[model samples]
Target: MTLAKGPLFLLVLTALALTSCQSDDKPPQPRFTSDASGSQVGKASQREGQYFIEFRSRYALTYGHTYAVFGRLNKAGGMINPQVAGLAPASADAAPYVLGHFIPVPATTGATDGDLEEAYRSASWRILLTEAEYNKTVAFIRQLQAKSKLWQATVDNCNNFVGEIAGSMGYKTPSIWLRPQEFITKLREMNT
Candidate 1:
């Protein structure tokens, strides 16, 4: 080769060699982190006094009370007029049935971040799917669990485990396992 081209060719080869030798393995560290006050770091908390909302307002995602609100609505013949959420009785009648709700965020004011928070607040649950959306939520949770240090701590059930984790993000636990259908049924019973 030429005199100047020799050094350039060697540099390129060396870079390629180094890149090829790099490992794909991730370093060991906890997937979740916290702050000085024992609160989770990053955006792991949710704002209080707001309902979970998707683009169409048909899908609501919530953990404790907000989820209860949805249940209340559904049981009331598919609508709930909550005083806190500023929802009117008429609003529920017009909107489609809420679907695929999640309680990923904590119900704390100004708190941010919960893996499931935003999706709960802003997903399209009205579109029917062959599979249960909660199943997908559970799968996503498993992925999160894999990334966490508490791998040994099993999520024996979806609602229970999700509630426990949500507490870490700053939410109160509900007294039930709370699958979508059950939630709807519970709400209906309460209203009647």
Candidate 2:
């Protein structure tokens, strides 16, 4: 027995329709968690005193146009003391700068008051994270550091490092083409 062309076409169309309907029933998964409990899988949150992830950018003349670029970018290492979200106290002598670097030398570094002052001078943007979320993010960065090889100027730079940290905090990773400035803008738009 042979099947007719019209009947075969109908059967194929029916199968496609059923598959599409099945996929539609499932809800889309969340990229990050905003729950205060911090129990949700793949979500990060803190209990109190906002946890901020900042992106600091520096500009340099590239080619002929002087575009806004990231020369030496930094992330505000977890919690800067005195319980301030974005502000770093100038008089706080013991304030340690917890920063991650792309260079092969341990993926992370610490700076004191003077270094922090210079680094914070660049245009910076902040996003709040919870204490639990902050701990998880720090762990993730440590793991990446241990496994990662030396940083490549073009391949694995500071922007890529920040992108990974952002991803851990449940933020969507921006396109590779986006510079630090553009990535921060996109992050602020999505977060706010």
Question: What overall lDDT goes with each candidate model?
Answer: 0.28, 0.38
Summed over model 1, clashes come to 9
Count of clashing pairs, candidate 2: 4
The candidate maximizing lDDT is 2
State residue 122's C-alpha deviation in candidate 2, in Å.
3.9
Distance from true position, residue 52, model 2, in Å? 3.1
On TM-score, the candidate that comes out on top is 2
Which ten contiguous residues of candidate 2 have the minimum total lDDT? 63-72
Q: Mark the regions of model 2 whose C-alpha exceeds 4 Å error after superposition.
A: 1-50, 60-115, 118-120
- Provide C-alpha RMSD values for all models, in order: 21.4, 18.0
TM-score of each prediction: 0.19, 0.44
